[model samples]
Target: MCRWTRQDRQRSHPLNIQRDEYARRRRQLMRMAGEDAVLLVAAAPERIRNADATWPYRQDSDMHYLCGFPEPDSVLALLPGRKHGEVVLFCRERDPEHERWHGESIGTERAVELHGMDDAFPIDDIDDILPGMIEGRGRVYCHFGSEPEFDARLLGWMRRLRQLRGGGVVPKEFVALGHLLHDLRLYKSRGELKLMHASANIAAEAHLAAMRMATVGRHEYEVEAELMRTMRSRGAVAAFPPIVAGGVNACTMHYQANRAPLRDGDLLLVDAGAELDCYASDISRTFPINGRYNREQRALYELVLEAQLAAIDEVRPGRAFDAAHQMAVRVIAEGLCALGLLAGTADDVIADGSYKRFYPVKTGHWLGLDVHDVGDYRVDGEPRMLEPGMVVTVEPGIYIPPNDTTVAERWRGIGIRIEDDVAVTRSGNDVLTANVPKDAGEIEAWLKRGMS
Candidate 1:
């Protein structure tokens, strides 16, 4: 059987992301901020899942972007034109007992060597050390309000610096880190695209597994479990909670109970993705629980598929960011009118916002470190233009609520969505998650092939 073998896992988890990549990113951001500003980024704090157990620790995206350090109780400081060192890191010191309980941490010395940092120190001395480093800077750039405790500590340091007139200088302004950082993150580097492609391929495998296992009499959670097994075996985790909605349950956009039993003649919508090495890939596919779509289900599924393809075609360099969404909406609106679900013309339906009853959300969003990744959809009060290296999700869905009386009885309670991760290239675009079949006929054939 084709599965995620040990060799396959090793091949997918490559050493493409090197210290040089992180160093390059740091240098670029520092040059953008200039010599007058100091940038501070903190690692994500560990959260309690319940009484004593802690949830899995994930590093902050900005921190990961700046330096590929993966640890809690860590802080990064980028001081432009510093005489001693331009890049500094404060992280947990080596502790034998702590390492025994948890895991070995990237101590100061290792952090500097492995992550290309100029200097590293124990995090406990941040209060005594960091303020001195920041004293002379004119502006402090940090992602404030994200971690209130860290924000308070930063403010306290500034307050302390103000009190000490002998201190060299105090920053006069505080800037949101996202202003300069997010834009840098939007463009995927060669290393990032490699990881994202691996991520998408892993998720596609899991979706195929789910499709094969989702037979009538199977519970939704069972299908979800299969997806988890497939992704986890590949050293990846779900980007978000897998949405395994069947039949009428699919009408709710974010239905995540994942406990419903599969029924024959019902369409199953599975919106799930996998995160590989912190890079994410999102894909959504609707197929038949019994391995074949009926007449009514196939009709709507084809419409959603058409919309998704039309939207994906618009993901090209120099194209408007919203162009894909507009095309998808137009296609769906026309399809709904043809099916007698809407009364007016496609243009009139869109202009009057009458099509929202069936399709409420936008076509898609940015996809990366976070499932719904960063990067502004609009800039200067207008939709931004698509650029090479930008990755987006082209998802177009139609949901008909079970109780809505406007639709025919057969059409009601049917929901369909087709999503794929597309990366804009210099030539045109590439579908990262195309391994999983999206066409109705292809889906039926794939399901008939059984487990891989």
Candidate 2:
């Protein structure tokens, strides 16, 4: 039975986002204002994947951060430095015609009650009501260059305000709200950490299920099906298109053409994630299709695993954001030299950029609401230091192409990636997805246990 039904979704617990959080964020925005600053954030619209087929609806990250409301066609307005300076949500009204085709629509009253907004109004009245909301505001803070439609609407709003400038009503400045919100989202709250941990657990279970279900002669899509099924069964959704690559295809990053059949001697890379309550957990694991790694595959897998472990160890509060990447690069360089993939010494190979031949991508990236979550790692042209409550992925891989003649035939067509979600802490790093097996021996044991 599917655990992610509409009923289950409705019964889900409300996130514990206090009203003070929104008040605090608004205060911070108001502090940046030269005069009256009004911030506007819009919710994401449901996109159509094809004719009459719509993609799963997910709330905008900024909107979710402010109100925790998941409904579509919603807009949040914040008039900072005012007596009533709080959130006001503009949302869809209940209509039987649209409600019959789509699911239920939470009207403005319910939106205000459920989301703790100061006030609410029907979305259809946005054109008539928004100008009044912006009449006395001196600065209009919104996400510019984000949505062309919204940009046009903003221009029209400003034009309307300009037309009424004879009445002494016009915004003096326009600023991008993304700058402020992005900085705020860099640090996770306790509630966010709880949701992120839940997401990581779901991803871990799904990956383990895929590992156990894998076997020789099975198609890559079959493994993907198992992963999706496991995730859905656990009341979660995929964060992104799961990558199930086998043999030579594993070397292709972002490989989604999961149509190839698994070969007995080939390696399989599954880069998948589970989204729980809109929080994302990204993890990648590579193992043999037949449940036992050969000599060359084991060597490369161990190397990548070693590099990943070293990178994870470097994750700590106050460390530079690039410290883990540098650590992983050093480990990869040393491993490549040991495997004879590079000719020179470790330092020389790293200095000459020979490491890129094997490790092309970065070691990892920040993980959260989006698969590659938002946050500026560098501020003022310097690396931003890691802080507690920040979640990130540590993924390291070595891909040896099938056509590369520099290596032996047995070593070709092997790609291995080991990924896990890590949360930086004052004490150390917490491996959120540690429940999933990664060690080569444990993976083999899991396969054996499944067969038994």
Report, for every candidate in turn, its global Cα lDDT versus the true structure. 0.91, 0.84
Worst 10 residues of 1 by lDDT: 4-13
**Winner by TM-score:** 1
TM-score of 2: 0.95
Prediction 1 TM-score vs. true: 0.96
Clashing pairs in 2: none
lDDT by residue for model 1 (1-452), tens: 76563323433456446778889999999999999999999999999999999998887988988887888999999999999999999999999999788866669997877778999999999998898889878999999888999999998888777767665678899999999999999999989999999999999999998988899999999999999999999889999999999999999999989999999899999999998878999999999988888988888899999899889989999999999999999999999999999998999999999999999999989988888889999999999999999999999999998998987898999999899999999999999999999889988888888833
**Model 2 local distance difference test score:** 0.84
